[model samples]
Target: MESLQEKNRGYGSIFRNLNFFSIWIGQTISVVGDFLYIIALMWWVLEKTGSTAAMATVAICSSLPAIILGPFAGTYVDRVDKRRLLILMDLGRGVLIAVPGVLYFLNQLQVWHIFVIAAFLSSMSTFFNPALASFLPVIVNKEQLVRANSISQMSSNLSGIIGPALGGALVALFGAGTVMILDALSFFVSVIAIFLVRVKVEQVFPSEERKRFLQELMDGLNFIRKESGILGLVVLFSVLNFFVAPVGVLIPLMVKKILKMGAEGFGVLGSSISVGMVLGSLFLGMIGGVRRKGTFIMIGIVVAGSFLALFGVSESFWTSIFLLGGCGFGFSFANILVPVVFQSKIPHEKQGRVFGTLGTISGGLRPISLALVGVMGGLLHIQMIVFLSGVLVALGGLTGFLIPGIKKL
Candidate 1:
């Protein structure tokens, strides 16, 4: 692993590393499967229950694990073999997600079953995600991280473009149960793809007399505090998430209420953002390494926020599409760079915990932001709330320039 980093290979060499390529392929397949699974599951729930509340309940169940198990999950990831853990997560999710399809076939499927499976799956991801973050540095050289992330980002965006349309069509033709079964099969394929990867990970901590879980968790938190700009970055992202959360909730309203464009218009607006992200990632990949990463992060945020503010004021549907696309393009810069910063700045041994802590903070913020959006939705016009949120987000990005902690990073 150390030898790979020392090589300092060119950007295109990222794909030549079979280890990284294997995992990337696995992750790409898994991401698309996830979209298929979610669309099928949510659609089935809505179709059967005829209640939006049930759909929301399922969503809440899926998110609870990350908020609850985040720190602990990270600690565990640091203590174990990440490769084995990734396989286990894929295996577990593949099986658990299949339960719904099996039950449906047996005429025993229930809303509660979906809830339980979703929670358990989320718990697995809480560990899997951090482990993957920690594992990446081990497989690829440092020089490849940016391009690797860009390619990964591109795959996700591509999946976003393809998955929902394919999932919806499959669900319409074959039923949700069949779509879910196929998703399960996709995970198994991921397991195989992951199994082919090979790498030797060094032991970071001594085996004997390890600290208690809570102590290690605090150590992770303290690391964040002591590190330059990291804590600020975390705070920035948490607040940014709060401001951005409303965009998803309000887009449909803007299309339906303001533009009177309905579901077809909403789909078009959504796809535009995904297309923009794909292009943004491609551009980043072409540029290779960015010298002033902090400046890039702030620029990305401001661009995204500016477009979002424009989106709020867009009375025309086509205008809203353009604005949302710009929002996605701007978002990609910050999204890809933030992880690169973390992966580069943090120690490999502590990366798991740091990533875990990030998951907790971000996941914990989701519900609060949603609730605030709901409250603001009732009091003020949607346009006002979105415009204000965008302005605040843009200003929040500007703070990175003012605060020495973030600016110097």
Candidate 2:
């Protein structure tokens, strides 16, 4: 008995209320641009310096700033309007990216320029992530959190699949500077998409009129310390991150040294992982949401770690590709579970601080892991190093069993 207009209105309301789509679209654009910039920057550094350490430095600098600024950024995100915060973060990054692009065109490009820009962009992203993570639950219904996170993961994976291939061609044809220009433009597009979304912010601790900065920070830390389930998840993820960090540095080495492939091969290797991630994400999205998310996450991590270890040992290109792809799929599956749990359990008001603290711990450890991986890979064989990383991840998974909630999830 319902009219078509009424039916359509129902659909319209459903779509509009789901702010995940908006965030997903914006992130997709930004991620693709980021991929392009990453390829371009790495190539630019290699061309200029011809040093693997120099190239590795790019990764370290990019991550360190976020680790340093994460706590303060998280605290600020909780206090501010998340929508505007995202917009401003995008704009800030866009302008920073433009600095190098403009200078490169004017023939003033240098390795230091890339380092500075990478650090600046990384710092901006520290603010952006905690805000975005905390904001998602506010805009989307709790029932849709898993689906929303899955869709977001799909967008990121798709970007990973497409962006590197596009970046390779662009780097070959137009140069890194041009690719950077494209990245800067993508940020503008993201800013526009974020601007269109409307969100209702909930204040968690209404009784605390105002608190000192250090007091507020300590409060966030205390919240995490008090929440056993959340604390356990954070510890579990941090250990996982420590082991997984090697993959980024070691993948390039494997393609270049072990596989004896060039830049195109590197692109192919990266794209292969992305392909698997996309498929995994699609599977998760179609399923709506997993009921036993923690269990699923643990299983995924175990599978991913196994694949990564196999990937390190494989000699044939196809074997390596398949293993890496499998790893990507498992990684995506595990990734979707974490954010859903965080959004579901953590109070909306405290999300910023909690996620920030988690970010600080996880993000801080990554670069140290990368540095260790780089140094170890340099000192030992790449395969052995990678295999060790995989072993660590698998061992870390056992920690989940110790945390009862994680095993139950």
Candidate 3:
């Protein structure tokens, strides 16, 4: 009871801190704009190209830049001023996305323009993501970390919920071009929000010191290599990505083909997961955070995977929704805890690079998994594949408990 009351107090404190609140509010607005912009962009592409392949190409293009640039992006993040980097990234992406809107109005838009702009924005995300992740630990104190992160996660989830619904309305009224222009305008709001943040940033590298790019990159790799817990984290995610990532491909097919639930079912299933994420993050915030992070993470992963496995075998739509909700809840619990663990362990100086490297390894697995799932799902039963993958994820998650380095951390 005492602990619970303390956690309640912590939640109140998070909102009271004006600096963090300013950033969070601005970020929430921009994120909502991002959601609407993406829906519009995708709608525009499908209309223009009339090609599923084009859609896949755009998705692949978005992932590729982060995979390729993640490590180096982190190095630069560690070296420079994060506030400026963030502002620049948002500005560049804003300008890039806005151009298509103008070109479309002028009736001079080309197919290649969308493709190129998509790639450019994606590349900027590699820098922006890590910088944002690293920045929070600096601005927010350790005690406030859990509530702050929960607030951040909640805002993001809210955007996802609001984005599509709001985007659809805007598109119906003013079309994709207007949505894109509004999206660009959101970036300016983000820039102004960031400008309002008045916190001191202690530089990671000295002004006089300049190391070779490759050497700086290698230092980050070595840091991960030397830390067994970090390596365990990387390897664990790689395994999840390989086996579990394919579930993304399998879920829609399973819904349409096996369950015969169609698009509404798909939307319902998505909403279930989103609800779980929002609720789970809120729950974590209410409880503050767990100290035995690895153990909590291990439990979270195993439970989430088990629920996913159950979701695969479910016949009824409601049952599948229940199981998926459980899975989402468990994963969200663990996800929040993992970042708290990482922020505590990593130095403020190397946070950007470390986070970048982690992001790369985490996201890099999807393409390979998607490829294999695409092929294998065509040949074999997708539900069975999903079932087996869930089991593998559970098994893989257990390995963390077995590894002393990670478990004890």
TM-scores of the candidates are 0.86, 0.92, 0.83
The residue-level lDDT of candidate 1 at 344 comes to 96
lDDT tens digits, residues 222-292, model 2?
88787777777788888888888777766766776789876666667777888888888877777765887
Q: Per-residue lDDT of 9-123 in model 1, one digit per residue for the tens?
A: 4555777789988988888888888877766786677557744346546656777788889999998888888989999998998998899989988889999999899899999
- The lDDT-based order of candidates, best leading, equals 1, 2, 3
Cα-based lDDT at residue 64, candidate 1: 76
lDDT at 135 for candidate 2?
86
Q: List, in order, the clash count of every candidate structure.
A: 0, 2, 0
Q: Output the number of the TM-score-best candidate.
A: 2
Cα misplacement distance, residue 15 of candidate 2 (Å): 4.1
Candidate 3: where are CA atoms >4 Å away? 1-9, 37-56, 99-115, 164-182, 206-208, 249-268, 313-320, 374-385
Stretches of model 1 off by over 4 angstroms after superposition: 1-11, 41-57, 102-114, 206-209, 249-269, 313-318, 373-388
Error of 2 at 40 (Å): 1.7
Error of 3 at 85 (Å): 1.0
Task: Estimate the TM-score for candidate 2.
Answer: 0.92
